[model samples]
Target: MLERIGITNFKAFACQDVDLAAFTLLTGLNSSGKSTVLQSLALLRQSHEAGLLDEADESGGFLLNGELVRLGTGQDVRHESYTEEDPDITLAVVKDEIRYAWRARYGREDDLLGLLEAPSGPTSWATRDLPSLFGHGFQYLKADRIVPDVSYPRSHDAAVRRSFLGARGEHTVNFLRAHQDDTITAKSLQLPEMPSTSLREATDYWMQRLCPGVNIETVGIHGTDTVRLSYGFGSGVSASNRYRPTNVGFGLTYALPIVVACVAAQPGSLILLENPEAHLHPQGQTWLAYLAVAAVSAGAQIVLETHSDHVLNGLRLAVKDGRIPASATAVHFFRRNGQTAEVISPSMGPDGMLSDWPKGFFDEWENSLEQLLD
Candidate 1:
C-alpha cells in the first residue's frame, strides 16, 4: 500500500503531504483538489510506463509539450496551480521494507532543465530497491462514466481472468459469464459429495445479495454467439428483462464495474474511485461502502474521492457493526484557500466515532439546517 504521497506545484497543491491508510476516503467541496491527487498518481504511472520518467533515471525529467518539465502561468491544465517560483513535483511511497521518492523539477527548457532525484531510505527520501508497482495495481473508476452500454462486447474466454471492466461497464455480462462456469465448478469441487444443485443454489444466493428478490440465470440460444443473461423476481413472478446498459438507471451499471473490479482485483492493488456513490440511492450508497470495506479486507487498498455524507456514514456504520476494523480506514477532507489545498485526516475508532472532529468538517448540512430554521 502507498503510505504517503507528497505533491508540490502540480495542481491545486503547492506543497503537501498526505498520509494514506489501507482505505482512505477523500471528501471535499468542489475544486478542493480531490481529483488532482488521483490524476497525479495516474500521470506518474503513465510517465514511468512510457519511460519518460523513472525512479532511478536522471537527465530526462518529466517533459511537457515535448520539452523538459515547464511551469505554466495559468490553470490551463486541470487542477493545475501556477506559482512565481520554479515548480517541483515529488511522489513518495512505502512498499514492503523500502520507501521510495521520485522527484523532478518543473520549468521551461530555456530556463533550466531540472534534475530527477531519488534518495535512498529507511529514513532516506529515495530507495532504488523499490520495485516499480504497475499494472492492475491501480484501477481508477469515475462515476456515471463507468457504466455499461450496448457497444460492450461479451466474452467467454476461459484463459482470461482478472481483467478490468472498461470505463463503461460494457464488458460486465461477458465477464460474469466467463467466470460463472469456473466459479461454480470450483465451489462445487470443494465440497465432498456436494449435490449438483449446490452450485445453482449458491449462484442464486449471491445474486440476491446484490438485488433482493432478483433472480439471475444464463441461457444459451442455439444461433447466438454469446450467452444471454435473464432476470426474474422470485417464483411465479417472471418476466423477460430488457436492459440496455445505457438505458437502465445509472446506479446499477455504475455500481456493477466496481463490484466486478473489487472481486477480480489482486492483492497489493490500488483502486482509486471518484464518487462511487454517484447516481446511487442512499441505500445503494451504503451497500457500495460495504463493498469497499470488504475489498480492503480482501487485501486491496482503496483511495476514494467522494462528496456523499451517506457514504461516509455507511462506512462508520460498518466499523460499528464490526464488519471492518476501524483502524483499517482513514478519512481525509480537502479544504481550499485562495490557490492551495490542505488535507485534514481524522481517524475512525472501532465504535464508528471520530477521535477528533475538525471544525467545518461535515458541517455543511448543519449550516444549511440552521439557515432554514433561522
Candidate 2:
C-alpha cells in the first residue's frame, strides 16, 4: 500500500505531503485543490508507467511546470506563459520499505525530461517498478458523467470480455459479467440473503441498500443483432419500475458506478472515487459510505472525495461497528487561500471517534439554519 505521497509544482498544489491509510477521505469546498492531489498521483503513476524518470527523480530537486518546486504555490501550472526555466514537477512515494522520488525539468529544447530516482532506503521495490503496480492496480471514477450505454452489436465478432469499465462507466455490465467467475463475485453471490432471482438480483440488492424499499431488475434482450441491458425498479408497493436511464432518479444512475466499481474491483486494487455521494439522498449517501468500508474490508484501498457530512458520519459508524479499523482510515480537509490550498488531517481513534473537528467544517448547514432563523 502507498504509505505517503509528496507532490510539488503540480496543478493547484505547490507542495503537499499526504500520509495515506488504507481508506482516505478528502473533503473541502469547491476548487480548494483536493482534486489536484488525486490528479498528481494519477500523473505520477502515468509517468512511472511510461518510464519518464530515473531513481534520482524521487528527490526534492526536480523542477515542475516552470515554477520553482515549492509547496502551496497557487499559480496555474498549465498556463501557456509558464516557462521550464523554473522546475515545476516533483513527487515521491513511500512504498513498503523504500522511498522513491521522480523529478522533471523542461529542457531548453522544449522537451520534458523526468528522472525516476532509485529508492533511498531498503531496495525492496524501485520507483520505476511502480508503473505496472499502479497501472492496473488503481481505478479512478470521476463524477462528471454517469455510465453510458454498452449495448453489444449483433455482429458475431463482438469481443467476449470488454476492458474494465471505461472512465464514464459505459461498460459496467460487460465488466461485471466478465468477472462473474472471480473469487470475489463467487463469494458475494454465495451469501444466503442475496436474491438469486437473476443477474439483476445483485444489482437490485445494491440499489436497495442505497434506497430502501426500492427494487431494481436488469434484463438483457437480444433483438436480431443487438443486446442491451434494461433497468426496472419498484414493484407493487413502491414506485413503478422505469425502463429508461433518464426515467430513474439521478441519484440511482449517479450512484450506479460506485456500486458497480466496488463490487467489481479485485483485491489489492486502489479505487479513487470523486463524490460517490453525489445526487444521493442522506440515507443513500450513508449507505454509500458503508459500501466503501465494505470494499476496504474486501482488500481494496478506497480514497474518496466527498462534500457530505452524512458520508463522514457513516464512516465513523463503520468503525464503531467493527466493520473497519479506525487506523485504516484517514480524513483530510482542504482549505484554499489565494492560489494555494492547505490540508488538515483528522485522525480516527480506535474507538471510532474523530480526534478533532476544525471550525467551519460542515458549516454550510449551520449557515443555512441561521439564515432561516434570521
Listed in order, each prediction's TM-score against the native is: 0.75, 0.77
| Residue range 16-89, candidate 2, lDDT tens digits | 78887888999988888777766666555444444444345433233333211122222334322343564546
For model 2, where is the 10-residue window of minimal lDDT?
65-74
- In candidate 2, stretches whose alpha carbon ends up further than 4 angstroms from where it belongs are 48-86, 107-137, 147-163, 180-192, 196-200, 213-227, 234-242, 370-374
| Residue 206 Cα positional deviation in candidate 2, in Å, after optimal superposition | 1.6
- lDDT for 93 in candidate 2 is 75
Q: Give the per-residue lDDT of model 1 (tens digit) for 1-374.
A: 77777777767787777777778899887888787777666555544544545444545444332211223422333235645564556655666645556666654332222436755333222213432245544566655454444443555432145354543444555666665553432321222332342334434443344566554454444566554554556556464455444544555656666665555545677787878877777777776787677667667788888888888998899899987788888898898887789888888989999876776777888999999999
Clashes of each: 6, 30
lDDT of each: 0.61, 0.63
Backbone clash pairs in model 1 (N, Cα, C under 3 Å; residues 3+ apart or in different chains), count: 6
User: Model 2 misses residue 366 by how many Å?
Assistant: 2.7
